[model samples]
Target: MADITVKVLEPAVSYDLLTLDELKTILGISTTDTSEDALLEMWIDQYSDVIATMCNRVFAREKVQETWRGDLPPQDCARVFLTHYPVVDADIESVTCNGATITDYEIENRSGKLTLFGSWSEPIVVVYSGGYLLPDEAPAALKTATGILVTGARSEMSRSTISGIKSISHRESRVQFFDESGGSSSGAGAIAAAGDTVNALLYKYMRFYV
Candidate 1:
Protein backbone atom coordinates (compact mmCIF):
# COMPACT_ATOMS: atom_id res chain seq x y z
CA MET A 1 0.00 0.00 0.00
CA ALA A 2 1.19 3.51 -0.83
CA ASP A 3 0.77 6.58 1.31
CA ILE A 4 -2.76 7.96 1.17
CA THR A 5 -3.39 11.69 1.06
CA VAL A 6 -6.74 12.99 2.24
CA LYS A 7 -8.26 16.45 2.07
CA VAL A 8 -11.55 17.55 3.55
CA LEU A 9 -13.70 19.33 0.99
CA GLU A 10 -16.37 20.25 3.56
CA PRO A 11 -16.09 20.52 7.30
CA ALA A 12 -17.42 17.69 9.47
CA VAL A 13 -20.76 18.20 11.24
CA SER A 14 -20.58 21.31 13.39
CA TYR A 15 -22.97 19.96 16.02
CA ASP A 16 -21.91 17.63 18.82
CA LEU A 17 -23.00 14.02 19.35
CA LEU A 18 -24.80 15.15 22.51
CA THR A 19 -26.81 18.34 22.48
CA LEU A 20 -26.35 21.01 25.15
CA ASP A 21 -29.72 20.24 26.64
CA GLU A 22 -28.94 16.52 26.81
CA LEU A 23 -25.62 17.10 28.47
CA LYS A 24 -27.14 19.55 30.90
CA THR A 25 -29.80 17.04 31.80
CA ILE A 26 -27.20 14.33 32.40
CA LEU A 27 -25.21 16.73 34.54
CA GLY A 28 -28.35 17.46 36.58
CA ILE A 29 -28.38 21.12 35.72
CA SER A 30 -31.73 22.87 35.60
CA THR A 31 -32.91 23.74 32.12
CA THR A 32 -32.81 27.43 33.06
CA ASP A 33 -29.16 27.39 34.07
CA THR A 34 -27.13 29.23 31.45
CA SER A 35 -24.06 30.01 33.51
CA GLU A 36 -22.24 26.78 32.59
CA ASP A 37 -23.57 26.58 29.08
CA ALA A 38 -20.35 27.71 27.47
CA LEU A 39 -18.21 25.44 29.64
CA LEU A 40 -20.37 22.43 28.95
CA GLU A 41 -20.26 23.14 25.23
CA MET A 42 -16.47 23.21 25.39
CA TRP A 43 -16.41 19.85 27.16
CA ILE A 44 -18.68 18.35 24.53
CA ASP A 45 -16.36 19.40 21.70
CA GLN A 46 -13.26 18.20 23.50
CA TYR A 47 -14.72 14.79 24.34
CA SER A 48 -16.15 14.29 20.85
CA ASP A 49 -12.73 14.85 19.32
CA VAL A 50 -11.19 12.52 21.85
CA ILE A 51 -13.65 9.74 21.00
CA ALA A 52 -13.02 10.10 17.27
CA THR A 53 -9.27 10.03 17.76
CA MET A 54 -9.36 7.01 20.01
CA CYS A 55 -11.72 5.10 17.73
CA ASN A 56 -9.80 5.99 14.57
CA ARG A 57 -13.14 6.96 13.05
CA VAL A 58 -15.15 10.07 12.38
CA PHE A 59 -18.64 10.38 13.82
CA ALA A 60 -19.93 13.21 11.64
CA ARG A 61 -20.53 13.29 7.91
CA GLU A 62 -18.25 15.37 5.67
CA LYS A 63 -16.95 15.58 2.12
CA VAL A 64 -13.35 14.59 1.42
CA GLN A 65 -10.92 14.13 -1.46
CA GLU A 66 -8.47 11.26 -1.15
CA THR A 67 -5.53 10.13 -3.26
CA TRP A 68 -3.66 6.86 -3.14
CA ARG A 69 -0.87 5.31 -5.13
CA GLY A 70 -2.34 2.92 -7.66
CA ASP A 71 -2.16 -0.61 -6.38
CA LEU A 72 -4.48 -3.60 -6.49
CA PRO A 73 -5.10 -5.81 -3.54
CA PRO A 74 -3.90 -9.40 -3.37
CA GLN A 75 -5.99 -12.09 -5.13
CA ASP A 76 -6.71 -9.61 -7.98
CA CYS A 77 -9.17 -7.38 -6.16
CA ALA A 78 -8.82 -3.75 -7.25
CA ARG A 79 -10.08 -2.19 -4.07
CA VAL A 80 -9.01 0.72 -1.90
CA PHE A 81 -10.14 2.14 1.43
CA LEU A 82 -11.61 5.59 1.90
CA THR A 83 -10.74 7.84 4.80
CA HIS A 84 -13.94 7.64 6.89
CA TYR A 85 -16.91 5.35 7.53
CA PRO A 86 -19.64 4.08 7.91
CA VAL A 87 -20.10 6.11 4.77
CA VAL A 88 -23.20 8.34 4.81
CA ASP A 89 -24.10 7.45 1.21
CA ALA A 90 -22.35 6.12 -1.86
CA ASP A 91 -22.28 9.54 -3.45
CA ILE A 92 -18.88 9.66 -5.08
CA GLU A 93 -18.41 12.95 -6.92
CA SER A 94 -15.47 11.93 -9.07
CA VAL A 95 -12.85 9.25 -9.59
CA THR A 96 -9.58 9.94 -11.29
CA CYS A 97 -6.62 7.80 -12.27
CA ASN A 98 -3.52 9.91 -12.63
CA GLY A 99 -5.37 12.88 -14.19
CA ALA A 100 -7.99 11.18 -16.35
CA THR A 101 -11.49 10.68 -14.96
CA ILE A 102 -12.92 7.18 -14.68
CA THR A 103 -16.51 6.09 -14.04
CA ASP A 104 -16.47 2.31 -13.77
CA TYR A 105 -16.27 1.79 -10.04
CA GLU A 106 -18.33 0.52 -7.12
CA ILE A 107 -18.41 1.69 -3.54
CA GLU A 108 -19.05 -0.27 -0.37
CA ASN A 109 -20.04 2.71 1.73
CA ARG A 110 -20.10 1.12 5.15
CA SER A 111 -16.66 -0.38 4.64
CA GLY A 112 -15.16 2.46 2.60
CA LYS A 113 -14.12 0.12 -0.21
CA LEU A 114 -13.78 1.41 -3.78
CA THR A 115 -13.46 -1.21 -6.48
CA LEU A 116 -12.22 0.00 -9.80
CA PHE A 117 -13.03 -1.84 -12.99
CA GLY A 118 -9.62 -1.92 -14.64
CA SER A 119 -6.01 -1.01 -14.06
CA TRP A 120 -5.13 2.69 -14.04
CA SER A 121 -2.09 4.90 -13.82
CA GLU A 122 -0.02 6.08 -10.83
CA PRO A 123 -2.30 7.81 -8.34
CA ILE A 124 -5.96 7.02 -7.78
CA VAL A 125 -7.93 10.01 -6.60
CA VAL A 126 -11.49 10.00 -5.31
CA VAL A 127 -13.79 12.70 -3.99
CA TYR A 128 -16.70 11.61 -1.83
CA SER A 129 -18.76 12.35 1.27
CA GLY A 130 -19.22 9.83 4.09
CA GLY A 131 -20.09 9.28 7.79
CA TYR A 132 -23.24 9.83 9.87
CA LEU A 133 -25.14 12.81 8.52
CA LEU A 134 -26.86 13.62 11.81
CA PRO A 135 -26.27 13.02 15.48
CA ASP A 136 -29.34 10.80 15.63
CA GLU A 137 -27.77 8.58 12.96
CA ALA A 138 -24.78 7.87 15.20
CA PRO A 139 -24.73 4.48 16.90
CA ALA A 140 -26.27 4.34 20.35
CA ALA A 141 -23.01 3.05 21.82
CA LEU A 142 -21.19 6.17 20.68
CA LYS A 143 -23.74 8.44 22.31
CA THR A 144 -23.61 6.42 25.52
CA ALA A 145 -19.82 6.63 25.54
CA THR A 146 -19.94 10.38 25.17
CA GLY A 147 -22.28 10.59 28.13
CA ILE A 148 -19.96 8.51 30.30
CA LEU A 149 -17.02 10.73 29.49
CA VAL A 150 -18.95 13.92 30.14
CA THR A 151 -20.24 12.61 33.45
CA GLY A 152 -16.81 11.49 34.54
CA ALA A 153 -15.29 14.85 33.64
CA ARG A 154 -17.98 16.70 35.54
CA SER A 155 -17.38 14.53 38.61
CA GLU A 156 -13.66 15.24 38.43
CA MET A 157 -14.31 18.97 38.27
CA SER A 158 -16.44 18.84 41.43
CA ARG A 159 -13.61 17.43 43.49
CA SER A 160 -12.07 20.03 45.83
CA THR A 161 -8.58 18.54 45.74
CA ILE A 162 -6.16 18.80 42.84
CA SER A 163 -7.37 17.07 39.67
CA GLY A 164 -5.31 13.85 40.12
CA ILE A 165 -4.78 13.94 43.83
CA LYS A 166 -6.16 10.81 45.50
CA SER A 167 -5.73 12.11 49.02
CA ILE A 168 -4.59 15.21 50.89
CA SER A 169 -2.67 14.65 54.12
CA HIS A 170 0.62 15.66 55.72
CA ARG A 171 2.18 12.23 55.22
CA GLU A 172 3.64 11.37 51.82
CA SER A 173 1.10 9.30 49.92
CA ARG A 174 0.88 8.20 46.31
CA VAL A 175 -1.72 10.25 44.48
CA GLN A 176 -1.64 7.94 41.45
CA PHE A 177 -0.98 4.18 41.74
CA PHE A 178 0.06 1.75 39.00
CA ASP A 179 -1.01 -1.86 39.44
CA GLU A 180 1.55 -4.31 38.13
CA SER A 181 -1.07 -7.03 38.45
CA GLY A 182 -1.61 -6.75 34.69
CA GLY A 183 -5.19 -8.03 34.99
CA SER A 184 -8.48 -6.26 34.28
CA SER A 185 -6.80 -3.49 36.24
CA SER A 186 -4.71 -2.84 33.15
CA GLY A 187 -7.84 -2.54 31.09
CA ALA A 188 -11.24 -1.01 31.93
CA GLY A 189 -10.37 -0.87 35.60
CA ALA A 190 -8.11 2.04 34.73
CA ILE A 191 -11.02 4.09 33.56
CA ALA A 192 -9.54 7.54 34.20
CA ALA A 193 -6.31 6.56 32.48
CA ALA A 194 -7.98 5.11 29.36
CA GLY A 195 -10.94 7.53 29.04
CA ASP A 196 -13.60 5.65 31.01
CA THR A 197 -15.85 3.36 28.98
CA VAL A 198 -15.68 5.39 25.77
CA ASN A 199 -12.86 3.41 24.17
CA ALA A 200 -14.60 0.11 24.78
CA LEU A 201 -17.76 1.38 23.11
CA LEU A 202 -15.72 2.88 20.28
CA TYR A 203 -14.12 -0.45 19.41
CA LYS A 204 -16.92 -1.30 16.99
CA TYR A 205 -16.47 1.98 15.14
CA MET A 206 -12.78 1.57 14.45
CA ARG A 207 -11.82 1.61 10.76
CA PHE A 208 -8.83 -0.06 9.19
CA TYR A 209 -7.23 0.22 5.74
CA VAL A 210 -4.63 -1.68 3.77
Candidate 2:
Protein backbone atom coordinates (compact mmCIF):
# COMPACT_ATOMS: atom_id res chain seq x y z
CA MET A 1 0.00 0.00 0.00
CA ALA A 2 3.01 2.33 0.39
CA ASP A 3 3.34 2.47 -3.37
CA ILE A 4 -0.33 3.13 -3.94
CA THR A 5 -0.82 6.37 -5.88
CA VAL A 6 -3.95 8.37 -6.45
CA LYS A 7 -4.39 10.99 -9.15
CA VAL A 8 -7.23 13.29 -10.00
CA LEU A 9 -8.32 12.45 -13.51
CA GLU A 10 -10.84 15.28 -13.45
CA PRO A 11 -10.75 17.87 -10.73
CA ALA A 12 -13.91 18.90 -8.94
CA VAL A 13 -15.94 21.67 -10.52
CA SER A 14 -16.12 23.59 -7.25
CA TYR A 15 -13.94 23.15 -4.19
CA ASP A 16 -15.65 25.85 -2.14
CA LEU A 17 -17.50 24.41 0.81
CA LEU A 18 -19.43 27.69 1.24
CA THR A 19 -20.88 29.64 -1.64
CA LEU A 20 -20.50 33.44 -1.95
CA ASP A 21 -24.16 33.96 -1.10
CA GLU A 22 -23.79 31.67 1.90
CA LEU A 23 -20.85 33.68 3.17
CA LYS A 24 -22.72 36.93 2.64
CA THR A 25 -25.75 35.59 4.41
CA ILE A 26 -23.60 34.39 7.28
CA LEU A 27 -21.96 37.82 7.58
CA GLY A 28 -25.37 39.49 7.68
CA ILE A 29 -24.66 41.26 4.41
CA SER A 30 -27.02 41.71 1.53
CA THR A 31 -26.37 39.12 -1.17
CA THR A 32 -27.12 41.72 -3.86
CA ASP A 33 -24.40 44.02 -2.55
CA THR A 34 -21.32 43.71 -4.74
CA SER A 35 -19.10 45.99 -2.66
CA GLU A 36 -17.10 43.26 -0.91
CA ASP A 37 -18.05 40.34 -3.07
CA ALA A 38 -14.56 40.07 -4.54
CA LEU A 39 -12.90 40.02 -1.15
CA LEU A 40 -15.42 37.54 0.20
CA GLU A 41 -14.95 35.36 -2.86
CA MET A 42 -11.20 35.36 -2.29
CA TRP A 43 -11.67 34.30 1.30
CA ILE A 44 -14.03 31.55 0.27
CA ASP A 45 -11.43 30.12 -2.11
CA GLN A 46 -8.49 30.60 0.24
CA TYR A 47 -10.20 29.29 3.35
CA SER A 48 -11.69 26.42 1.42
CA ASP A 49 -8.21 25.31 0.39
CA VAL A 50 -7.00 25.84 3.93
CA ILE A 51 -9.82 23.66 5.25
CA ALA A 52 -8.91 20.95 2.78
CA THR A 53 -5.29 21.22 3.90
CA MET A 54 -6.29 20.96 7.53
CA CYS A 55 -8.56 17.99 6.87
CA ASN A 56 -5.95 16.30 4.67
CA ARG A 57 -8.78 15.35 2.33
CA VAL A 58 -10.89 16.96 -0.38
CA PHE A 59 -14.57 17.13 0.40
CA ALA A 60 -15.60 17.95 -3.14
CA ARG A 61 -16.18 14.82 -5.18
CA GLU A 62 -13.87 14.40 -8.14
CA LYS A 63 -13.01 11.76 -10.69
CA VAL A 64 -9.81 10.01 -9.70
CA GLN A 65 -7.54 7.27 -11.01
CA GLU A 66 -5.70 5.18 -8.47
CA THR A 67 -2.85 2.74 -9.02
CA TRP A 68 -2.33 0.14 -6.36
CA ARG A 69 0.59 -2.25 -6.15
CA GLY A 70 0.51 -5.79 -4.92
CA ASP A 71 1.02 -6.28 -1.21
CA LEU A 72 -0.11 -9.87 -1.08
CA PRO A 73 0.71 -13.16 -2.75
CA PRO A 74 -0.05 -13.63 -6.45
CA GLN A 75 -2.65 -16.28 -5.72
CA ASP A 76 -4.18 -14.52 -2.77
CA CYS A 77 -7.38 -12.64 -3.51
CA ALA A 78 -6.94 -9.98 -0.87
CA ARG A 79 -9.00 -6.93 -0.14
CA VAL A 80 -7.40 -3.62 -1.19
CA PHE A 81 -8.22 -0.09 -0.15
CA LEU A 82 -8.73 3.04 -2.25
CA THR A 83 -7.41 6.46 -1.30
CA HIS A 84 -10.70 8.39 -1.50
CA TYR A 85 -13.71 6.99 0.31
CA PRO A 86 -17.50 6.98 0.15
CA VAL A 87 -16.96 5.80 -3.39
CA VAL A 88 -19.63 6.33 -5.98
CA ASP A 89 -19.91 2.63 -6.75
CA ALA A 90 -22.10 3.02 -9.81
CA ASP A 91 -19.77 5.71 -11.18
CA ILE A 92 -16.76 3.43 -11.10
CA GLU A 93 -15.75 3.63 -14.72
CA SER A 94 -13.12 0.93 -14.91
CA VAL A 95 -11.00 -1.50 -12.97
CA THR A 96 -7.99 -2.97 -14.67
CA CYS A 97 -5.14 -5.18 -13.61
CA ASN A 98 -2.02 -5.43 -15.75
CA GLY A 99 -3.85 -3.79 -18.65
CA ALA A 100 -6.76 -6.22 -18.52
CA THR A 101 -10.22 -5.13 -17.41
CA ILE A 102 -11.82 -7.34 -14.80
CA THR A 103 -15.30 -7.40 -13.37
CA ASP A 104 -14.83 -10.12 -10.75
CA TYR A 105 -14.68 -7.70 -7.88
CA GLU A 106 -16.82 -6.11 -5.22
CA ILE A 107 -16.63 -2.54 -3.94
CA GLU A 108 -17.41 -1.43 -0.41
CA ASN A 109 -18.68 2.13 -0.85
CA ARG A 110 -18.24 3.55 2.61
CA SER A 111 -14.86 1.94 3.22
CA GLY A 112 -13.51 2.29 -0.33
CA LYS A 113 -12.29 -1.29 -0.19
CA LEU A 114 -12.24 -3.58 -3.19
CA THR A 115 -12.31 -7.31 -3.03
CA LEU A 116 -11.11 -8.83 -6.24
CA PHE A 117 -12.46 -12.31 -6.92
CA GLY A 118 -9.36 -13.26 -8.87
CA SER A 119 -5.67 -13.17 -8.03
CA TRP A 120 -3.21 -10.92 -9.80
CA SER A 121 0.50 -10.30 -9.50
CA GLU A 122 0.41 -6.97 -11.30
CA PRO A 123 -0.75 -3.59 -10.13
CA ILE A 124 -4.41 -2.66 -10.12
CA VAL A 125 -5.88 0.55 -11.54
CA VAL A 126 -9.24 1.92 -10.48
CA VAL A 127 -10.97 4.91 -12.08
CA TYR A 128 -13.81 6.24 -10.05
CA SER A 129 -15.46 9.30 -8.46
CA GLY A 130 -15.41 9.67 -4.69
CA GLY A 131 -16.17 12.17 -1.85
CA TYR A 132 -18.91 14.70 -1.27
CA LEU A 133 -20.16 17.03 -4.00
CA LEU A 134 -19.21 20.23 -2.16
CA PRO A 135 -21.44 23.23 -1.22
CA ASP A 136 -24.41 21.19 -2.34
CA GLU A 137 -23.70 17.85 -0.67
CA ALA A 138 -21.07 18.89 1.86
CA PRO A 139 -21.92 17.96 5.44
CA ALA A 140 -23.41 20.61 7.69
CA ALA A 141 -20.53 20.45 10.15
CA LEU A 142 -18.01 20.92 7.35
CA LYS A 143 -19.97 23.88 6.02
CA THR A 144 -19.98 25.42 9.48
CA ALA A 145 -16.24 24.93 9.76
CA THR A 146 -15.72 26.66 6.43
CA GLY A 147 -17.97 29.50 7.48
CA ILE A 148 -16.01 29.97 10.70
CA LEU A 149 -12.75 30.22 8.79
CA VAL A 150 -14.10 32.62 6.19
CA THR A 151 -15.76 34.74 8.86
CA GLY A 152 -12.54 34.89 10.85
CA ALA A 153 -10.74 36.03 7.75
CA ARG A 154 -13.38 38.67 7.16
CA SER A 155 -13.18 39.85 10.75
CA GLU A 156 -9.45 40.28 10.59
CA MET A 157 -9.63 42.36 7.42
CA SER A 158 -12.59 44.50 8.41
CA ARG A 159 -12.31 47.48 10.72
CA SER A 160 -15.70 46.78 12.28
CA THR A 161 -16.07 46.44 16.04
CA ILE A 162 -16.43 42.80 17.23
CA SER A 163 -14.23 42.82 20.28
CA GLY A 164 -16.27 40.59 22.58
CA ILE A 165 -18.73 39.16 20.11
CA LYS A 166 -18.50 35.37 20.00
CA SER A 167 -20.88 34.88 17.10
CA ILE A 168 -22.68 36.60 14.27
CA SER A 169 -26.35 36.03 13.63
CA HIS A 170 -28.21 36.58 10.36
CA ARG A 171 -31.87 35.73 10.11
CA GLU A 172 -32.31 32.19 11.48
CA SER A 173 -28.64 31.17 11.06
CA ARG A 174 -25.87 31.86 13.53
CA VAL A 175 -22.11 31.33 13.04
CA GLN A 176 -19.48 31.11 15.74
CA PHE A 177 -16.79 33.73 15.33
CA PHE A 178 -13.73 34.33 17.40
CA ASP A 179 -12.43 37.72 18.46
CA GLU A 180 -9.80 39.16 16.14
CA SER A 181 -7.44 39.83 19.02
CA GLY A 182 -7.88 36.30 20.33
CA GLY A 183 -4.56 35.27 18.67
CA SER A 184 -6.21 33.52 15.71
CA SER A 185 -6.79 36.25 13.17
CA SER A 186 -6.36 34.27 9.96
CA GLY A 187 -4.64 31.47 8.06
CA ALA A 188 -3.39 28.26 9.71
CA GLY A 189 -3.23 30.03 13.05
CA ALA A 190 -6.99 30.49 12.85
CA ILE A 191 -7.39 26.79 12.21
CA ALA A 192 -5.31 25.98 15.27
CA ALA A 193 -7.32 28.35 17.42
CA ALA A 194 -10.68 27.32 15.98
CA GLY A 195 -11.69 25.91 19.39
CA ASP A 196 -13.46 22.64 20.28
CA THR A 197 -16.36 22.79 17.86
CA VAL A 198 -14.24 23.37 14.77
CA ASN A 199 -11.65 20.88 15.91
CA ALA A 200 -14.29 18.25 16.56
CA LEU A 201 -15.94 18.91 13.22
CA LEU A 202 -12.64 18.54 11.36
CA TYR A 203 -11.46 15.53 13.36
CA LYS A 204 -13.50 12.89 11.55
CA TYR A 205 -12.44 14.24 8.16
CA MET A 206 -8.72 14.27 8.87
CA ARG A 207 -6.78 11.80 6.77
CA PHE A 208 -3.77 9.89 8.05
CA TYR A 209 -1.64 8.37 5.36
CA VAL A 210 0.80 5.67 6.21
Candidate 3:
Protein backbone atom coordinates (compact mmCIF):
# COMPACT_ATOMS: atom_id res chain seq x y z
CA MET A 1 0.00 0.00 0.00
CA ALA A 2 1.05 3.60 -0.57
CA ASP A 3 1.34 6.41 1.97
CA ILE A 4 -1.86 7.90 3.38
CA THR A 5 -2.72 11.59 3.01
CA VAL A 6 -4.68 13.28 5.79
CA LYS A 7 -6.55 16.60 5.87
CA VAL A 8 -8.31 18.33 8.71
CA LEU A 9 -12.05 18.98 8.19
CA GLU A 10 -13.18 20.56 11.45
CA PRO A 11 -10.75 21.83 14.07
CA ALA A 12 -11.03 21.14 17.75
CA VAL A 13 -12.76 23.40 20.25
CA SER A 14 -9.49 24.51 21.86
CA TYR A 15 -5.94 24.39 20.49
CA ASP A 16 -4.22 25.10 23.78
CA LEU A 17 -2.95 22.06 25.59
CA LEU A 18 -2.59 24.02 28.80
CA THR A 19 -4.96 26.73 30.05
CA LEU A 20 -3.70 30.26 30.90
CA ASP A 21 -4.41 29.71 34.56
CA GLU A 22 -2.45 26.47 34.49
CA LEU A 23 0.47 28.18 32.80
CA LYS A 24 0.44 30.98 35.35
CA THR A 25 0.54 28.44 38.15
CA ILE A 26 3.43 26.69 36.49
CA LEU A 27 5.27 29.99 36.19
CA GLY A 28 4.57 30.66 39.87
CA ILE A 29 2.59 33.82 39.14
CA SER A 30 -0.27 34.23 41.63
CA THR A 31 -1.17 37.80 40.84
CA THR A 32 -4.55 38.66 39.29
CA ASP A 33 -3.01 41.11 36.83
CA THR A 34 -3.90 40.47 33.18
CA SER A 35 -0.89 42.35 31.80
CA GLU A 36 1.03 39.22 30.70
CA ASP A 37 -1.99 37.29 29.46
CA ALA A 38 -1.36 38.10 25.84
CA LEU A 39 2.29 37.08 26.05
CA LEU A 40 1.39 33.87 27.81
CA GLU A 41 -1.24 33.10 25.16
CA MET A 42 1.35 33.52 22.45
CA TRP A 43 3.73 31.20 24.25
CA ILE A 44 0.97 28.64 24.63
CA ASP A 45 0.35 28.60 20.86
CA GLN A 46 4.05 28.38 20.05
CA TYR A 47 4.64 25.60 22.57
CA SER A 48 1.58 23.75 21.34
CA ASP A 49 2.95 23.68 17.79
CA VAL A 50 6.37 22.63 19.05
CA ILE A 51 4.92 19.79 21.09
CA ALA A 52 2.75 18.61 18.20
CA THR A 53 5.67 18.63 15.78
CA MET A 54 7.92 16.69 18.16
CA CYS A 55 5.27 14.08 18.86
CA ASN A 56 3.97 13.87 15.25
CA ARG A 57 0.44 14.19 16.61
CA VAL A 58 -2.21 16.71 17.66
CA PHE A 59 -3.44 17.08 21.25
CA ALA A 60 -6.86 18.59 20.59
CA ARG A 61 -9.62 16.56 18.97
CA GLU A 62 -10.18 17.33 15.27
CA LYS A 63 -12.16 15.99 12.33
CA VAL A 64 -9.96 14.64 9.55
CA GLN A 65 -10.22 13.02 6.12
CA GLU A 66 -7.60 10.53 5.03
CA THR A 67 -6.97 8.92 1.64
CA TRP A 68 -5.01 5.80 0.84
CA ARG A 69 -4.04 4.81 -2.69
CA GLY A 70 -2.42 1.82 -4.46
CA ASP A 71 -3.19 -1.84 -3.77
CA LEU A 72 -5.84 -2.80 -1.31
CA PRO A 73 -5.21 -5.09 1.64
CA PRO A 74 -5.13 -8.84 1.01
CA GLN A 75 -7.93 -11.11 2.14
CA ASP A 76 -5.82 -12.35 5.04
CA CYS A 77 -5.56 -8.84 6.42
CA ALA A 78 -8.59 -7.41 8.20
CA ARG A 79 -7.39 -4.08 9.56
CA VAL A 80 -5.54 -0.88 8.65
CA PHE A 81 -4.21 1.96 10.79
CA LEU A 82 -5.73 5.43 10.57
CA THR A 83 -3.66 8.58 10.27
CA HIS A 84 -4.46 9.67 13.82
CA TYR A 85 -5.34 7.87 17.05
CA PRO A 86 -7.88 7.93 19.90
CA VAL A 87 -10.73 7.96 17.37
CA VAL A 88 -14.38 8.36 18.26
CA ASP A 89 -17.23 6.36 16.65
CA ALA A 90 -19.61 9.30 16.55
CA ASP A 91 -16.97 11.35 14.79
CA ILE A 92 -16.42 8.76 12.04
CA GLU A 93 -18.56 10.19 9.27
CA SER A 94 -17.95 7.58 6.63
CA VAL A 95 -15.66 4.98 5.08
CA THR A 96 -15.51 4.66 1.33
CA CYS A 97 -13.76 2.17 -0.94
CA ASN A 98 -13.28 3.32 -4.49
CA GLY A 99 -16.20 5.76 -4.25
CA ALA A 100 -18.49 3.13 -2.72
CA THR A 101 -19.64 3.54 0.90
CA ILE A 102 -18.96 0.79 3.41
CA THR A 103 -20.74 0.23 6.70
CA ASP A 104 -19.25 -3.04 7.97
CA TYR A 105 -15.95 -1.61 9.08
CA GLU A 106 -15.09 -1.65 12.76
CA ILE A 107 -13.07 1.13 14.35
CA GLU A 108 -10.82 0.69 17.35
CA ASN A 109 -10.90 4.10 19.01
CA ARG A 110 -7.69 4.20 21.04
CA SER A 111 -5.57 2.46 18.40
CA GLY A 112 -7.29 4.03 15.38
CA LYS A 113 -7.37 0.66 13.70
CA LEU A 114 -10.10 -0.07 11.16
CA THR A 115 -11.16 -3.66 10.60
CA LEU A 116 -12.98 -4.19 7.36
CA PHE A 117 -15.17 -7.22 6.71
CA GLY A 118 -13.67 -7.89 3.29
CA SER A 119 -11.21 -6.64 0.75
CA TRP A 120 -12.12 -3.46 -1.15
CA SER A 121 -10.77 -1.62 -4.19
CA GLU A 122 -7.91 0.79 -4.17
CA PRO A 123 -8.09 4.46 -3.13
CA ILE A 124 -9.77 4.01 0.20
CA VAL A 125 -11.07 7.09 1.99
CA VAL A 126 -11.93 7.56 5.64
CA VAL A 127 -13.42 10.53 7.47
CA TYR A 128 -13.09 10.64 11.24
CA SER A 129 -12.16 12.63 14.31
CA GLY A 130 -9.06 11.96 16.34
CA GLY A 131 -7.08 13.15 19.42
CA TYR A 132 -8.12 13.92 22.98
CA LEU A 133 -11.82 14.77 23.28
CA LEU A 134 -11.24 17.25 26.07
CA PRO A 135 -8.37 19.20 27.62
CA ASP A 136 -8.65 17.01 30.71
CA GLU A 137 -7.95 13.97 28.50
CA ALA A 138 -4.53 15.38 27.57
CA PRO A 139 -1.68 13.59 29.30
CA ALA A 140 -0.31 15.36 32.37
CA ALA A 141 3.26 14.66 31.26
CA LEU A 142 2.68 16.64 28.06
CA LYS A 143 1.28 19.57 30.04
CA THR A 144 4.31 19.51 32.33
CA ALA A 145 6.62 19.38 29.33
CA THR A 146 4.94 22.47 27.88
CA GLY A 147 5.44 24.23 31.20
CA ILE A 148 9.16 23.47 31.08
CA LEU A 149 9.47 24.84 27.53
CA VAL A 150 7.55 28.03 28.37
CA THR A 151 9.68 28.61 31.45
CA GLY A 152 12.90 28.34 29.42
CA ALA A 153 11.49 30.57 26.68
CA ARG A 154 10.38 33.20 29.19
CA SER A 155 13.84 33.21 30.79
CA GLU A 156 15.52 33.66 27.39
CA MET A 157 13.22 36.57 26.55
CA SER A 158 14.10 38.29 29.83
CA ARG A 159 17.85 37.96 29.19
CA SER A 160 17.58 39.46 25.69
CA THR A 161 17.25 43.25 26.03
CA ILE A 162 17.61 44.09 22.31
CA SER A 163 15.39 42.93 19.47
CA GLY A 164 15.66 43.07 15.64
CA ILE A 165 19.38 42.99 14.83
CA LYS A 166 20.22 43.90 11.25
CA SER A 167 23.33 42.22 9.82
CA ILE A 168 25.45 41.20 12.84
CA SER A 169 28.44 39.20 11.66
CA HIS A 170 29.66 36.18 13.57
CA ARG A 171 33.31 35.11 13.68
CA GLU A 172 32.44 31.40 13.67
CA SER A 173 29.37 29.33 12.82
CA ARG A 174 27.40 28.18 15.87
CA VAL A 175 27.23 24.46 16.61
CA GLN A 176 24.52 22.88 18.73
CA PHE A 177 24.18 19.45 20.33
CA PHE A 178 20.97 17.51 20.95
CA ASP A 179 20.44 14.63 23.39
CA GLU A 180 17.53 12.50 22.19
CA SER A 181 17.22 10.96 25.66
CA GLY A 182 16.29 14.35 27.11
CA GLY A 183 19.48 15.53 28.81
CA SER A 184 20.33 18.98 30.14
CA SER A 185 20.85 21.85 27.64
CA SER A 186 20.39 25.62 27.28
CA GLY A 187 18.16 28.08 25.36
CA ALA A 188 16.64 26.41 22.26
CA GLY A 189 18.43 23.24 23.31
CA ALA A 190 16.52 23.30 26.59
CA ILE A 191 13.24 23.63 24.71
CA ALA A 192 14.27 20.70 22.52
CA ALA A 193 14.92 18.59 25.58
CA ALA A 194 11.47 19.41 26.88
CA GLY A 195 10.01 18.50 23.50
CA ASP A 196 11.80 15.16 23.67
CA THR A 197 10.09 14.52 26.99
CA VAL A 198 6.69 15.30 25.50
CA ASN A 199 7.37 13.12 22.47
CA ALA A 200 8.26 10.17 24.68
CA LEU A 201 4.97 10.50 26.54
CA LEU A 202 3.02 10.69 23.26
CA TYR A 203 4.87 7.95 21.41
CA LYS A 204 2.46 5.23 22.39
CA TYR A 205 -0.49 7.29 21.21
CA MET A 206 0.88 7.77 17.71
CA ARG A 207 -0.54 5.79 14.78
CA PHE A 208 1.72 3.45 12.82
CA TYR A 209 0.58 1.66 9.68
CA VAL A 210 2.08 -1.48 8.20
TM-score, per-candidate, Cα-based: 0.76, 0.76, 0.75
Candidate 2: residue 95 lDDT (0-100)? 90
- Candidate 3's C-alpha runs over 4 A off are 71-75, 134-136, 160-196, 206-210
lDDT of each: 0.73, 0.78, 0.74
Error of 2 at 81 (Å): 3.0
- Candidate 3 lDDT over 69-152, as tens digits, reads 765467555466776677878878999888999898888887788887865765779998888854567778777777888997
Worst 10 residues of 1 by lDDT: 181-190
Better of 1 and 3 by lDDT: 3
Which candidate gets the maximum lDDT versus the true structure?
A: 2
lDDT for residue 155 in candidate 2, whole number 0-100: 57
Model 3 poorest 10 in a row by lDDT: 175-184
User: Measured by TM-score, how close is model 3 to the native structure?
Assistant: 0.75
Error of 1 at 99 (Å): 2.3
Candidate 2 residue lDDT tens string, 165-204: 7788999999997644446445344434566777788888
